[model samples]
Target: MTTSMTKHALVVRGGWTGHQPVETTDSFLPFLKEHGYDVRVEDETTVYTETEYMADVAVVVQTNTMNTIAGDELSGLVAAVANGTGLAGWHGGIADSYRNSSEYLQLIGGQFATHPAKAPRDELPDDGTDCFVRHTIDIVPERADHPIVAGISDFELTTEQYWVLSDAYNDVLATTTIAARDFDPWHRPITCPAIWTRQWGDGRIFVSTPGHDLGVLNDKNVRTIIERGILWASR
Candidate 1:
């Protein structure tokens, strides 16, 4: 747990109501406070441009999905992280934001290419196939000794299993396998990272790709990993 008297956390949330950005981000507040952080919640990306403000922040917990970040805001955010401010978030919020910005994607180390099993039928082809399905995540035994996933075990979640385009720079902590199914007719099963941590200069980055909704976020394993991730990432 963080013991810094001046430790602060900023949570920026908005874009794509389906992710319940407000509710999900709010659920982490009490936990942050319990860990002795002064927390701020923002519904806009403008805070990224506040250099003086970002300078004092210890951690940034963002939940914006499918939104474009302005060049200045993106630059400020990247600079802050590179300078040792921690960055952490879940699902689309952190991994899927700023689709057009390769710099942002590279900074985060991953991007959400598709959640093969979570797309609506209407969004699919005329063949009437379904894309969303349930899946299980297995903690990497070698990496399980890491603080964020120390006591976590293999768990099952009935939510969208994201297929992410990730960089090899990430230190993968947990993973999920997608089997070849009717909806996604791939020739072989594909395994992808479910939770990971990385470094950007002096900063820390943590990401988890399982919180499709409150129920998943509420899961004991998922919740514990996320909480630990935040604390571990914070300065």
Candidate 2:
């Protein structure tokens, strides 16, 4: 295992508090440590500018939401990942981060456009309650054989289902469908990639969009998928 060596992982957390960056990143620290990683947690992006650290890093687990990244910082991150350091995150932490950097979006392979409902519901409603009601997510294992999602069956989640603007380069692992509910008023069903992996040079990138809060992250399947994703990306 990569972690059995002197592998280092950096957890950078900051940006929109609504995403609970610190708490969410903190929740994953133990898991990373248990895998034998020399982990470092930072609240700022300055660490990304440290070329020395970025050179040998194994994985970077980011939790920044809707923030601006400096040019040097962004460049440093891109260079590290392109040179083989892994990158992994969930929700706005990775997908919705650095909205202005097209390079960053291309590297991550997707961007969070909207969540549709503040909350989502199982059924469409006559009232506007469907606009923010709890809904279920059906995970389709398109890449069932992939290590990140192997043995994971379809599961449902009651959280913000993200509508992402993505590219065709991603190797989609799982997907969730959005019906033409009152909240979205879509003409037909919209299926979005819920989990995926991509390659950046010699590195791996993994993304999961179901983690809006701890409630969603704590789910057995979601946690397992993320844990496996981190390990897979590191390789």
Candidate 3:
């Protein structure tokens, strides 16, 4: 592939080791470079405080989970994206982060609520894998034409199936149904957003709910969706 080097991609990954932030994000470095991005990686979110640097970045691919972002740093990040810088990430890294910051949640347009296991008595695993039942990711029939998910058929995954809190503003491309088991508290099966995109101000945001570890990130469909999402979200 020829490098146009037309964009800058910033990978900000850290906060939780269970997610293997560094390893997971590193897997995509070659892809980004092949697709014309000059990638810069940071293990911390402090770069969010670099106003000019953040603004110049074409996209910020973040993977920090359950971490706190200082007010000023968060402000710079939000400001840059609002003015046209892109933001894209997967799983808890994007949705379950900065638990105390409602503004940050508002920016992503989604939040991880829970990932129910097989039995009600089953303790939740931080990794979110279903112990007994495999989860299915269904493409929204109406969204089969979206660039990020086009041609991708519905698929099943044994990994964590996320049940998230999201808004109607999101353009959801894929979803997974959390079946209500006899042992579960929720009587009705909950359908949650698995992959989606949001347009914030002049910037674009993309989120995929499947990434819990390297294996899931390496899945053909999951990887393709993430790659397309990143490119689509880039400035």
Candidate with maximal lDDT: 3
Number of the candidate with higher TM-score, 2 or 3: 3
Query: Model 1, 175: alpha-carbon shift in Å?
Result: 0.9
Query: Which digits, one per residue and each the tens of the lDDT, describe model 2 over residues 21-67?
Result: 98888999999999989999999998999988888889999989999
Candidate 1 residue-wise lDDT, 124-223, digit = tens: 5534224446788899999979999987789888878888989799999988888876555678888999899999988999999988778789999999
The digit string of per-residue lDDT tens for model 3 on 1-235 reads 1134458889999888988999999999999999888899998788998877777889899999989989988998899898888999999999998998999989999999987776555464535544435889999999999999999999988877889999999999999999988877789989999999999898999999999999999999999999999999988
**Candidate 1 wrong stretches, greater than 4 Å:** 1-5, 118-132
lDDT of 1: 0.87
Rank ordering of all candidates by lDDT, starting from the highest: 3, 1, 2
Prediction RMSDs, each to the true structure: 3.4, 3.7, 3.2
The weakest ten consecutive residues by lDDT in model 2 span 126-135
lDDT of each: 0.87, 0.85, 0.88
Name model 3 segments beyond 4 Å from true. Answer: 1-6, 122-133
Clashing pairs in 3: none
Number of clashing residue pairs in every model?
A: 2, 5, 0
